[model samples]
Target: MKVVIVGNGPAAVSAIKAFRKVDKDSDIVVLSAEEYPAYAPNCMENVIRGDIGDDALFYAGGFSFYEKYKVDLRLGKEVVSIDNKKKIIYVKGGEEVSYDKCLLAAGASAFIPPIPGVELGGVTTAKSLDDAKRIRKWILEGRVRRVVIVGAGPIGIEDAETLRYMGLEVSVVEVFDRVLPRMLDKHMADLYMKPLEEEGIRFYLNSQVVAFHGEDGWVEAVEIKKLGSDRSIYLPADMVILSTGVRPRTYLVEGTDIRLHVDEIKGRVVGGVLVDEYQRTSDPDVYAAGDICSGIDVFGRHRWIALFPTAQQAGAIAGYNMAGLKVKNPGLVDYNAVKTRMVTAGSGGLFEEADESHTFELDNQIIKIFLRDGVLIGYQFVGLPKVLSVNKNNPFLKDSITFKFTGQGLEASGVLMHHFMRYRDRKVTQKVLSVIKNGALRSLANPSHDIPLFSL
Candidate 1:
């Protein structure tokens, strides 16, 4: 079998590993638009902050990784289009190849909003190593002193912390009422306010950048408008960073015979490539995974969640199924964690979708768990660690805790998924029921051991 996988991110790497495990002799080829090897996108900030060398960014180091695995790699090659009828992929400069199976893990691109002045030189994005290099160049050349980040998501928050650590005055503007609105519940999000405030990062919640102003073709300031008010403010900025999330790079399938999942109401294929439990696309010979494809959500619905861990897991599953192993993704839940000099917070699942919620608060610590029908569904941990005995001096230095409810690794939102996959029709004994009722989430960590799974 000839397997061709596009993309060089976590998904593509994972697919290569899976395919090799099952069929080592298959003619496997991988294509990447980036010249560099696969590196952790989350660690790019460390590269910008000078905490690590550029070589550290590569996950497995240079082209030798592909060569070792006996997989043909087309680095610095852009896949222009695909001919589904002929089973051929066309690359830039008229390069073409035929494949029995193709995996579209093209991933996503940083979203650039329709705001004016974004074309200015000083504005950058937190997407690729190239963007990080540009930002580093600007900083090293002493071109930027004040940094304004537009968005308070994980990427925005991380960038703000890194810039502040570099001695640049950092300010964040978030459209939502709180930071990490998609990651944590409202109650849990409040714990992050004071720590970030103490870190000298200015925040403008419920506000958005309306436009950017530049002098001599470089960003100078940003014009922001507060929601529900006519008030507008201009913040001086030598550099502007757009952390406005990302959208699936589904352009490859456009104008092609490959099928896409179109929203019936919106009349658009805006979501992503639709894949079944096995990550097989509408084109039986083709498959997709990671950020580029929309898969099953925790609640058994179709949703697009482009997260790093999710991408790796989905890509591995897609590779296994593509290798004819017939594996499924189980389900995916949103898991996110962020930390700065002052605070650390992690959350999983859709707490707002829960029917009931509970909170446990102490000085500089908070834990909120959401439940539906007496079953644990979601949770958020904020403030200092649950216990500071591990590191007394630094309350912020705590191990990130992940509860394992399923056979999979530590999950942020696996309660519902565990029940759905393993305990859907099982009965809960009184002992197991009592343990769950008493917040026995820690007991579920040992998936290999006997901890009765709870049912809803």
Candidate 2:
């Protein structure tokens, strides 16, 4: 029994571990296009600002973990295509690998739009560990001072926060009217983004980058135009990061018998290869996970939630199904938490579809709870960093007051919402509101007490 996994990410690592748990004797081979050990994608932000090497972020405890599991880990081997009919994978360099079963966890890559001047030397995207290292190298070499981030997504904002912390002039340009359009609505985005603006991270909303102006084939400035107006601005830049978004590496199955699902959400295409509850695709011998595959959400909506936890669970499930454990994925909850020095924010589930919603505006915190017929359907919690407040000695304020204590609230909400989805009509929303209410009251009474506030 020989198994081949297509990536070296969270999904692939979990799949390998889970599969080994059931069938240790099965020969496992991992084919990763990256030339390094499996690394945690979430740590890229911190790693960028620090002087640590890539080895510090290995997902499966370095190569020793693969060795302990008796797995064959092939580096820099990009699977160009997989012939499902023949149960064979074709590598980019004409290498053919045969397997009894395969897990398509090839993950995703940063989507750099076909905008002019994008090929300039100083332009990069925050998708892989190397991307972070490159940016860090430029900063360390004094090559970066004015950083122009081309998108206002999580990657861009986080990068802005880090750069701003390092005393660099950071600015974000978003075609959308607000920041974090996918995770937050306009109003919520305003609340969370306001403090960051105060922190000196400029945001250009309702604008599009027309071109990247550069000299000597290296980026020098960005040319942007305000939509619906004859307004243009040229912002000087030492570096440009395309934080637009990501796309799954789907070329491997493009001409194969394997199926794919593509759909548009909020004007952006967000779909991948479809997978069942067991992580099985159309082909029985082939399974897919991670950002490469879309799974069912808690609302029974078949959508792709490109979050690390979701990928990890999907990989574990795919591994189980491959090991003959007949398990079904419990479905995903659309949840995410973004933490910065200026603020912390988290949102999840159904926001607009939820029938009734309530909001509590407390000191330096904003919490919104949405319910669909009394079920925990949606929520948005944000909290500003205490440093941002003018009243440094406010008697009712604690040290952090989250937006963890902000992003951690989302993790807490995710757990509670999962219970609601599992039990169905469990009346969990009321209990959730109670917890939220208690935090609000605690903030009003004594701000010094550490309460999460379901904060930003």
Candidate 3:
């Protein structure tokens, strides 16, 4: 069997490893648009901050990984066309390769919103290695001092932190009410925002950039509009960066046999190439994993949750099923963790703005849980680490819960329990349940055990 996988990010790497495990002799080819090896996308901030050298950010595997597995690793090659009927992929360099099975792990691209003067010089999107290199060069030239970031998401926040660390005046403008709105709520965001603002970062919440003002060819200022006001304000800026997050790169699959699903509220291609439990697309021969596929969350509703861990899980399952294995790709849960001088992690569901919530006291910490119809749908931790762990593993807690920790013992949370449960086939028992449930209790005897557990 011949397998052709597009993109060299986490999903593609996982797929390659899975394919080699099942069908070592199969002709496996990886087409990567990036010139470098696969690396963690989250490490972009560390690289910019000068904490870790750029070389260290590359994925653990080196060239030997491909040579040892006898896989074709094509770098700097773009797959532009897919002929479903012919089962072939046409590359940008005019190379056509037929594949018995095709996997689209193409990942996503940075979203650049439409705004006047956005095409001017000194404006860039921080998404790829090339982007990093260009930004680094601009900084080194000592021409960029005042910076304006157009998004207050994780990437934007990280960029602001890095720029401030480099002693540059930075301002982050967000159209949302809170920063990191996707990963954190308004309260949790305030915790991080305080520290950032203290470090000389300016925030413009509920504001939209209408135009970019430039002198000659470089950006000089930005025109923005604040919420609840019609007046526009101009902010001085030497450089502009767009960290508005990303959208699934479905342009290649557009007008093809593949279908794209749009989220009505967001009006973006939230999911691509709808797949079944086996990760097989509408066309059985075609499979998609990672950001290229639309997946259902823990709520059993269709939503796009694009994260590195989910991509890895989806890719492995797709590879296994493609190699004639009867493995069903367990759908993904929307999970994310953020730690910046403090740690906060959550999974499954979110405590939306339109929800009724309750707070409880645990030792010296406070645990706030969000419920919808008596189910523990979400939670927030803002105290001791021990208390955070206790709330994280509450048996009565809903499958979708978010936990935030302001103290040290957060690591002890049965965070790994869910992953272990998924990968292991052993039965769960009362003893195991007791251990997790009575984690906060010094005594296991006469413990509050409401559920029966099985042995492993």
Among these predicted structures, which one has the highest lDDT?
A: 2
Candidate 3, poorest ten consecutive residues by summed lDDT: 441-450
Q: Give one digit per residue, the lDDT tens place, for model 2 in 1-456.
A: 899999999999899889989998989999999888888887777777783564668857899989988989999998899999989999988999999999999888899989899999889997798998898888888898899998998888888887876668888999999998887888889988987887778999999999998989999999999998877799999899999988887777888867777565455446888888889989999999999988887677678778888899999999998988988988787777775656877777777787887787655567787778776677777765564333345332233332212444444445434444544444534444665666533332233432333231
Tens digit of per-residue lDDT, candidate 1, span 165-245: 677888999999999888776666766765666657899999989999987999899999999887889999999999998
The true-structure Cα RMSD of candidate 3 reads 8.3
User: Which is the better candidate, 1 or 3, if ranked by TM-score?
Assistant: 1
Scored by lDDT, model 3 comes in at 0.70
Ranking by lDDT: 2, 1, 3
Candidate 2 overall lDDT versus native: 0.80
lDDT of 1 at 365: 46
TM-score of candidate 3 on Cα atoms, chains taken together: 0.82
Candidate 1 residue runs with Cα over 4 Å from true position:
53-56, 339-341, 362-364, 385-441, 447-456
Comparison by lDDT, 1 against 3, better one: 1
Q: What is the TM-score of each candidate against the true structure?
A: 0.86, 0.88, 0.82
- 1 or 2, greater by TM-score: 2
For model 1, state the Cα shift of residue 452 in Å.
Answer: 8.7
| Candidate 2 worst ten-residue window by lDDT | 396-405
Please give the clash total of every predicted structure, in order: 0, 20, 5
lDDT of 3 by residue, 370-399 (tens): 556544454454333321332433332233
Off by over 4 Å in 3: 54-56, 262-269, 342-348, 353-356, 360-367, 380-456
